[model samples]
Target: MKIAFYGSSLLSSYWNGAATYYRGILGELARHGHEITFYEPDAFDRQQHRDIDPPDWCRSVVYPATEEAMRSVLAEAGAADIVVKANGVGVFDRELLEGVIAQARPGALKIFWDVDAAATLDEMRADPAHPVRAALPDLDMVLTYGGGPPVVDAYRAFGAKLCEPVYNALDPATHHPVAPDAAFTADLAFLGNRLPDREARVEEFFLRPAASLPERRFLIGGNGWDSKPMPGNVRHLGHVYTHQHNAFNCTPLAVLNVARDSMANVGFSPATRVFEAAGAAACLITDAWEGIEQFLTPDTEVLVARDGQDVADHLAALTPERARAIGQAALARVKAQHTYALRGVQVDALLRAQMKGANA
Candidate 1:
């Protein structure tokens, strides 16, 4: 199959959290003998901060963020067996959604791949005229990176023909255990781009815990967090690149996963970081959310925290040996059930089935 994927930057993880997810899924799809042409707009200084070059797995087209450029790309969609308009392209999203459907040849599958399904569903619910809401009925299917049953049901209610959650999984080749870097050594660390929806949760699960554990070192790595107030024990390393993530996870005694407000509320949406941390054998402490047991067994594979107090309590009781054991268990679980290889096979089967049904 030839897939034309329109998404945020695959070459940059600068402000695009979905970059790893795209690489994991699409790269594996390519390995499955599918041809992939990824279309990402050159916007938001992403081109200036690319983490990886275009890989052998896919043809990456970085087009100018202009109407003409968008039109040119949409014109090429007719050649693809599957045309995907992933959410959060950060430029001309509405036009791309409508245009992809318009440009796809008859019998070709058109999918709206939502990396942030919780937030997208909220938007659609609040405004019936949302572009995605309007596009749902026309789209052949809706594929989400994380949201489970709730998201699938919601998309179906909005007239989607099919909706499935393709949860985030580890790319072991890209994110595996590494020698600890002294610079990232900390009792606990949290890495995510600071955003409005997640800032408060970060304050609760990360900062507050840091404040409570004054003797323990805490690290924060991501963009736009330099100005945020933190406890004396917390070190802010703004914008750690993807290459350093393995060490960042390995060096820390434990890593924290704080979901955005919407994801936490929606339940079952695991951030990409969860799998990344697990793959690197980092003991993970995640904010309480639904469906965690579906991915990792709590208390053994992962540690769940209900609030800042729970995080502090977990940290206080954690021993180096205990952390290592938990980390190893999580790593084993993900390697067996959550690697991108497994996810790629699932996605390959789904796309092929859809194509067969369309022909029939």
Candidate 2:
């Protein structure tokens, strides 16, 4: 199948959290013998801070953030068998959402892939006139990265024809265990871009814990945290590039995964960092959320924390041997059942079945 995907930058993980998800899923799809063309607008300074060049797996087209350029790309995308308009392109999202469906050729499958389904659903609920809510009936299907049942039901309620959650998984070739680097060595580390919905959670789960455990070393790496106030024990390394993620995960004695406010409230929504940390064999401590067992067994494969106090207690009790055991268990579990190769096969089958049904 020839698929054209309109999304945030594929070559940069600068401010876009979905870059890894796109690379893992699309790269695997290409390996499955599907041709992919990724269209990303040159906005938000992402093009200036690209982590990787155009990859061999897909043809990446970076267009100017203009109406003319967007229309041109939409016209080219009409030739594809599948057209995907992923959420959070950071520029002209409304036009792309409606344009993809409008310009698609007869019999072509139109999909809206939501990387952050929980937040998108919240927006649609708050405003009945949301563009995505209006586009739901016209889209052939809706695929989400996470938010298991809640997201599915919410999209269906909005009149979507089909809805499914594709959940995040590890890409072994891209993220795996590496030798620890002194530059990133710390007791606990968190890597996430600062956003309105997530900043408070980060403060609760990460900042509070750091303040309580004054003796322990803490690290923060992401964009927009350089000016945030933090305890003396916490070190801020702003904007760790994609290339440094493996080292950042590997060196920390334990890594943290704090979901955004919407994701935590919706439950069953695991951020991409969860799998990335586990894939690198880093003992992971995540803020409490439902449906974690569906991906990793709690207390064995991962450590669940209810609040800052729980995080501090967990860190205090963690022994080097115990941490190593948990990390290994998580790594083994993900490798056995949660890899992008497996996810790619599942997606290919789903698309093929949908295509067959359309033809019939």
Candidate 3:
């Protein structure tokens, strides 16, 4: 099957958080003999800050941020077996959706892959006439990054015919345990773009923890944080590249996973960092989110922090041996059941079922 993915920059992680998810899932799909065409916009400085070249397995199409360019790109996307217009494409998302669904082959599956379903659902809930709500009934499928049952149910409530979670998973081929790097050496570290929805959580879970443990060294990697009033004990490494993630994860004694407000409220939503940290065999301490146990068992596979105090306590209580043990257990769990190979199988089943229904 040929899949057309229209999302954020595939060659850069600069401010595109979904880059890792796209690389893992689409690469696996390609490896399984499916063709993929990734269409990303040439905006957001992603081209200037690219960390990777286009992969050979899939065709990478970078179009300009203009209606004329998008019209042509959407036409090309429509030819595929499945056309996905993912959230946060950093372009004219509503316009692209209207164009893609209008132009796609009658037999082709037109999907809205909500890499951030929490925000999407919230928008639709607040405004019934939101563009996504209007598009839901026409879409063949609505796939989410996470939010489990609540997310699926919410989409259905908004007139979605089919909703499912295509959650983030570890890509052992891309992320794994690596030798620690001196530059990123820290007691606790976090890597995420500082978006409004997530900044409060980051402060509560990460910055507060660092403030409480003033003696401990902390590292923050990602853009939009350099200008913030960060703790003196915390080091901010602006815009860490995708290729350097393993080293970033490995160098920290324990890595932090701070959920955005929407994701945390929705529960069961694990960001890409959760899997990447586990894949790299780093001791993971995350802010409390419901349904997290379904992915990684709390207190065993991962440490759960309810607040800054919990984070401080977890950091203080963690010994080298215990941290190593947790990292190992987390790694074992993800590699066994949460790899992209497993996700590819799920996607294949979905495509087959959709194709069958189309034929019917």
Candidate 4:
């Protein structure tokens, strides 16, 4: 099948979390004999900070940050078997949503892939005229990164004909454990782009734990954190690139997963970090969230924490051997059920089913 995807930067993860997710799933789809064209805006710092060259499996089209440029790109995308307008494209999302739907051929699948479903839903509920909500009925399907029953039901209630989650999963080729890098070594580490919605949680789950254990080394990676103040023991490495994720995860004695408020409330949503950290075979201590166990078994494959005290206690309790055992179990779980190859097959089946239903 020929697929056209419009999303945040595909060549840079600078401020985009969807880069790895796009790379993993789309790359695997290519391996399964699907042709893909990914359209990304040349905006923000992504173009300047690009960390990856265009993949052989994709035609990575970069257009100028203008309405005319996007319209031209969408015109081209409209002819594919599937045309996707993903969340957080970083510019003119409302226009793109309308353009993709308008230009898509009648037989082509016009999809709105919401990488941040919880947040997207909130926006629609807050304002009925939000482009996604307006486009819901016309969309062939709505795909989400996270959200299981509740998310699907919400989309249905909002008038979507179909909704499915293509959850984040491991790309072994990209995220498997690598030798630890000295620069990233720490007792605990977290890699997340600092966003307003997650900063308070980061403080509660990460900063407070650091304060509680002054002697332990804690590392924080990702951009937008350099301006924040931190405890003396915490190391802030601004903007860790995609190539560095494996080493970053491996170097930490244990990594932490703190979900943003929206994702936490949505339950079943697991961020890409969950799979990445697990793929690195790193012991993971995550903040409590509903439906977490469905992804990774708590107290066995992962450790769950309700507060800073819980985080500190878990860190103190895990001996190296115990931590290693947990990491291995988590890694095994992701490898078995959550690799991108598996996800690609699932996506292909869904698309085929949708196509069959369309014909019938």
Ranking, TM-score, top scorer first: 1, 2, 4, 3
lDDT, candidate 3, 34-129, per-residue tens: 899999889988999998899999999999988899888988866788888998887898888887788888888999989999988888878877
Estimate the lDDT of model 1.
0.95
In candidate 4, what are the lDDT values of residues 28-141, reduced to their tens digit?
Answer: 889888899999999997999988999888999999999899888989866798989999998999899999989888888889999999999999899978888889888999
Distance from true location, Cα of 307 in model 3, Å: 0.1
Candidate 1 structure quality by residue, lDDT tens digits, 181-243: 999989999999999999999999999999999999999999999889889999999888999
Candidate 2 TM-score over all chains jointly: 0.99
What is the RMSD of candidate 1? 0.7
Task: Report the lDDT of model 4 for residue 79.
Answer: 74
Residue 314 of model 1, lDDT score: 98
lDDT of 2 by residue, 1-360 (tens): 999999998999989999989998999899999899999999999999999999998999999999999999999878999999999998899999999999998888999999999999999989999999999888899999999888899899899999999889999988899999999999999999999999999999999999999999999999999889999999999988888988999998899999999999989988889999999999999999989999999999999999999999999999989999999999999999899999899889888888888878
Provide the overall lDDT of each model, using Cα atoms, as 2-decimal numbers. Answer: 0.95, 0.93, 0.90, 0.92
Mind sharing the TM-score for model 4? 0.98
Model with the higher TM-score, candidate 1 or 4: 1
Model 2 scores a C-alpha lDDT of: 0.93
Error of 2 at 109 (Å): 0.1
Q: lDDT of model 1 at residue 32?
A: 93
In candidate 3, position 159 carries an lDDT of: 82
